[model samples]
Target chain A: MRAACHAPIRGDFTGLRGLEWDKMLHCPAQAARAIPTISAATSMSQTRHVFFISDGTGITAETLGHSLLAQFPDTRFRNHRLPFIDSTDKARDCVQRIKDAAIESGIRPIVFNTLVDPSAVAALREADALFLDLFEKFIEPLENELGQRSTHAAGRFHGIADSQDYKKRIEAINFTLAHDDGVSHADLAEADVILVGVSRSGKTPTSLYLAMQFGIKAANYPLIPEDFERNRLPVELTRYRGKLFGLTIGPDRLSQIRQERRPNSRYASLENCLHEIESAQRMMKREGIKWLDSTAKSIEEISTIILQEVRLDPQSY
Target chain B: MRAACHAPIRGDFTGLRGLEWDKMLHCPAQAARAIPTISAATSMSQTRHVFFISDGTGITAETLGHSLLAQFPDTRFRNHRLPFIDSTDKARDCVQRIKDAAIESGIRPIVFNTLVDPSAVAALREADALFLDLFEKFIEPLENELGQRSTHAAGRFHGIADSQDYKKRIEAINFTLAHDDGVSHADLAEADVILVGVSRSGKTPTSLYLAMQFGIKAANYPLIPEDFERNRLPVELTRYRGKLFGLTIGPDRLSQIRQERRPNSRYASLENCLHEIESAQRMMKREGIKWLDSTAKSIEEISTIILQEVRLDPQSY
Candidate 1:
């Protein structure tokens, strides 16, 4: 990886110096426009580079970095993850790579470091970039607040506390997978929440998200035309009224979403969508079930709201 | 929420004052051991309270805070998330809750904040707690590195970007869902990667993660007894050789995992697991297919290694 980065910098810089200073700046931009790969090596504004450096799996760094970067949608970034940078040698090599990237791109890369070792962190600080140390910024304050010093351990963030947590999450996943689309009636009562909605109304994703993120057993049952026509909850769900959460979408949006799956069908028609949604909404209201319009909500927002309303904590089993 | 917090504080603190000074502190610890919920309210050493405060979905704060807290596994935390604190009044309410928590618990709380607006952030800072602001700590350095100011806009982190990104992810998900278990051979060629594995070998979660996180269209096909008996790749998979990635598991682990799903069946038998794994490994090696043992890895780890090995960038379409 180091050789790959350095190889491009040495070759590019030598060729860059042969041209006049003014042309040197302009030539790369023109070449970059013509060739997409050259954009990272030429224009700083054209590409923003981000490196998530961690001593473990780098998932946490990537998750936090991605969330932060998502706020800047106008900025385009090329991302890289360097996980298991625990030693001083690896940290030094990482710094060199960042510097080489800076030399080649005329852009300093942003480094999100979760490196806990002081020496390794210091080595990375020498790089020609913005080094944001996640631990350094918060650890001391946390220690003082808690009246305890941190262990500064690596990989603990992802280490299975016991087989229990792993088992719980997997069981939730398996339950969510099995109970999907009301496939199994036996486990309906076991679900923390039963999500009801029209087809493609974001039930599958939301159920999976709830199970995966919060260890909540979420079972989703689609409200079909039969149930809509009857204007009643499914017989199996009538017993678990307290666990039911309803999801509805705008009729036009539902039509558009369904049309993509099966075009020109009655199932994907706007009339069907309106009828199903109206019937489902009426049923939910009559039963005093809280519901959300999922047409404009992201899965995260929808899941968060549901979790809050249900009083489920992500940490609790 | 405000009423809930203040009600507890008013009830708990006065009772705490009536006890002897040293016993007031020690009594809570004793009470905490007897009562788990009291651990959050009484003993500082017995339990740590953490607040992930954000002006958005709070995913970033929860993720980073969880990672940091994971290091101190010995310390138990009672966590609360306060999202969408977009106004000063909301911020003030948040501070009041934090202050009340401190009064009730007899310990200061640790706050992980992602507040962007200056006034809202300042209001949160006034609370008697350890305030670790993610944006405040890293944004200025990022600005210096990029030679530009940040927009600090709320909701952009998760806002739908011209519907293109949302569409691509959803399409990938739909494709993955459709192509799951080799349900549709017609679109096999459209997949960016195809996962071949045995039953319950972590294929479903891995495929979903790749599609949802990286926007990679992944299809998974199970390696069955037929493929094992023949000691060859499936005929349907031969055409998309370059896109094939294999997942294997330790026989014992596989048996244990499968036993939970279908106890005492041939599918969950140790003999069946050994035969399947041995045959699959031999076939994968003979076919020059890259594979990984998923027995000891999480879905995140499995998906990440696959993405890295294939050199797929999540940022790209």
Candidate 2:
């Protein structure tokens, strides 16, 4: 089956309703194939050199490349990123590197490029590899649809062109940094959203992703043992109850994550994880707050769900 | 002019050249168009609601929206994001919210959606807005080209399917957090690349971006005042000279940035910024280190250039 198989909304798929923590971990595909694979060739596939080359941040190329590569699970990949190759000479150097990688791996490297400059793109095309030019593939179709030619820009996708947008993102990032880990609740009023969770519950990364990607001032507060013991929301968070979003993790997963941070301690114990998660969920339910599980989800999934729930303005940072 | 106009590599365009600090700030676009506009419509435009509705992170929708909106700078946009709308009921709520936005603003809102679920997409189509379904627009053409039907997956784009890739990214992020700001250089050899820059030269954000986006275990070390006085590379960095990539900024811009952090102090003074930048540049030149200016660049640009220069394996992290 393709990796892009649709994960049916099996658990608490209710829209805008209370997103259950446990129900969110349901993976339909995993249930269909519960047994581990015993294929020997899966481990012996030739390691191919995959390159995500771009003329900007290389983020789009990486994202697209990863999505495509995820389809072939048996193929072993060694990825090398080549970003901001705008000049012809840099492109030539990139070609040399690709050739070297191909020689070292004894297999032709796969190149995924979004180069805007024709000269640079041409130089890399000469390399011995299965070259995939994303811009070359889609720009023509888009131009035909829009009835206008593309600018062939290099840095505009994620560049600092609009100072206003740049300032908003920077301000949001700084705000997130300042409000991280319940560091300060004095300026909670300024926050667009406040995330509450126990330690190692994917709060920090989710908060940063929301700030960086959507320009939302996301402030995260850790629900410590004291907060769980009190059996109530903190006084600072009481005023911003409407902006509160909760994150919970499975006890097993939470225990493993905490063990990495603080090994052989009460905090890392499975019992402690279960206790904290149960208390946090009870408090969240009592206070009428929506929650989601972070154990089976990525930071992108968590942040996207939060944004959908709150309906915050993405461009109003 | 669209903000997507290609930035011609005018100043110091040579590939991997000296990369002079002051020369990097020469933005030709700014030169061609200077001074704030006295146009009154810029501030008085009617505010319009924009929504990037998706079943994923809404990143692609946001990118397309921003690029399209850049062509019409006079339009004041208030963007709200609605992601992970996988059910028909949630789609109804989204339509209601869109209608409410139109009612409040007295203008039909603009909605850019990439909804994968057909039922959800249908419900959203009933909303009173300029609905642009990016998926519906291009999916058929892509299907025809590939001779295969798309999975119509909702979460596959950003889902946690490949546990290995997810683990590598999380590990890289952990490594970056542990090694931030020269906190611990004990495991510096494990880093794919090490960034060296003076204070506030955009090291932390760039380091985090590299780690999170490309799965590169990036470590950054700040060039302190004593190092500048000594006029030599730090002892800890000398061992990883080949892994070193320097970041420099224009003195005036550096002073302005510093002033924001420590207002009205010697650290933010123009003289101090100039001295540090000059000394840092001289030291970098003497050591034959390749550097880029962060004065007018974004973290994305800085990180992209570093990746291109170092050619680190993105998947090895």
Candidate 3:
């Protein structure tokens, strides 16, 4: 069964503009009053129920499910995440919860499942919903191509299978913490990547992400005004020229970000931000260090670009 | 265009056991020699090439693709991630890269694409690979269910859409950093969850994961010998009893973890680990705080369980 019925248009008609803009500016109350006739005409469902169930952490299921749901911008989805459903009893309970959501929504709920255990999957298959068995759909094709059967193991993806890899990730996190903000030169040579940026230009979070997610020992150094006056990179960083990557933010965004930390301070002024960014860019160019603008991108985007631009293999790290 | 032909078995015969065992112990050299006759007989292909292409960071495509590939454990896949493929020019360049991979590997490459732009998707369709368009497959069904045409936007999943949400994530990161290891008690009241655990028991990484992934303000405190000696919870944590969550690790695992940090020290001894764990468990039970074992679970699993146990809505944070 599928939830093909139309739902009530609860929000703004501005969405109908079909242009990409800031969604946070969307005022629901004003939208409701702006298109009363359309809202009155469409009234079949309230909210669609979406469930992401997995044998492990359900991160993959939730991520893929969310990406699919984002395609429909006007629809409201009430999401339910059921992770670590490895046992048949837990799967049975999951089926009950999904059935309840289906009944509550007056339509079949959409389920994105990544359960690998046969018994648990069999139990969850009893649920009356649009069951999108993510693992089952792709495993057969992969098995055929590989000329082998899958392990059908539960919790393998996110599980700590390799002790060495797990230890590396933990060590990387500790290394990053100890080396944060140029606090330690003890292990500068051990770092896989070193980030340089003006204060609050998104160095710490990016370094943490590289360490936590990819097991890359990332060290970050703040490019202060002293370096700008000297017209040179930090003396400590000169030895690791190949590992250095720069982050630059737009002056306006940098100023706004700084204002939150220090209200009405000279450091938070737009002129200071502009000067700092220009100097950082010039130094990076002189040092032949590749850099990117962090003003409009998320940390994930910035990290991925850094990895590609620096040609750093995360797996090797 | 699918590469359905069998590939040469390069790894060990022990994988034929089909039993859940330590994959890290599977020595490829031994496996290659053990199955020499079978390896000699099969000579169709060497390795398969896979690409993850998207308009944004391509994280979702890479994640889902990795999950699918994990099902085929015996096969070797060469992965190429191409992010920010937003224009037709970039998509055409991406097709050339895939074609080059196909030529190099002597097999048709597998492409997992999440490009939303119609022109870019069309340009990528010219590639000679098993094109698995993730967004296209699900968007049409979603559009039918929602009874509206999709905006066909790109980079919506990981893009910083809401400035408020972005700020909350940054603030959460900062809050978790400041509160790490009980360094600060200034904003304990603002925390959504506070984790208590012995040192090296996986508290810091889990706290950071909670902050980074969900934007939930998490503070973690280390339970030291003083608290165990006193046989009570910390006085500062007594007021916010409802937000307390405990993490315990297996004594053996804890000892090994500590030994890496401080070798041959009394703190890393097995006896000390056992006593600390027992005392922490007793204190947690006495205080009626919920807790979990963090020895075998990843930070993602532990964080998800903590959120569920505490009934903390990450979205609300």
Which candidate achieves the best lDDT against the true structure?
3
| Interface DockQ per candidate | 0.20, 0.10, 0.18
B34-85: candidate 3 lDDT, tens digit per residue: 2223334334467887878888777777777777776677788877777777
Scored by TM-score, the top model is: 1
Q: What is the RMSD, in Å, between candidate 1 and the native fold over all Cα?
A: 9.8
**Model 3 TM-score (2 dp):** 0.84
Tens digits of per-residue lDDT for model 1, B213-304? 66789999999999887777889999987788888888999999888879999999999999998888777767766677888877766776
Candidate 3 backbone clash number:
1
Q: Is candidate 2 or 3 superior in TM-score?
A: 3
Q: Which stretches of candidate 2 lie over 4 Å from their true place?
A: A1-54, A68-82, A85-154, A184-189, A230-243, A286-289, B1-51, B68-80, B88-113, B117-152, B315-317
Looking at model 3 chain B, report the run of 10 residues with the lowest lDDT sum: B1-10
**DockQ result, candidate 3:** 0.18
Interface RMSD of each: 13.5, 19.6, 14.2
Residue-level lDDT of model 3, residues A267-299, one tens digit each, is 999999999999998888777766778887778
lDDT of 3 at A288: 71
Which candidate, 1 or 3, has the higher TM-score? 1
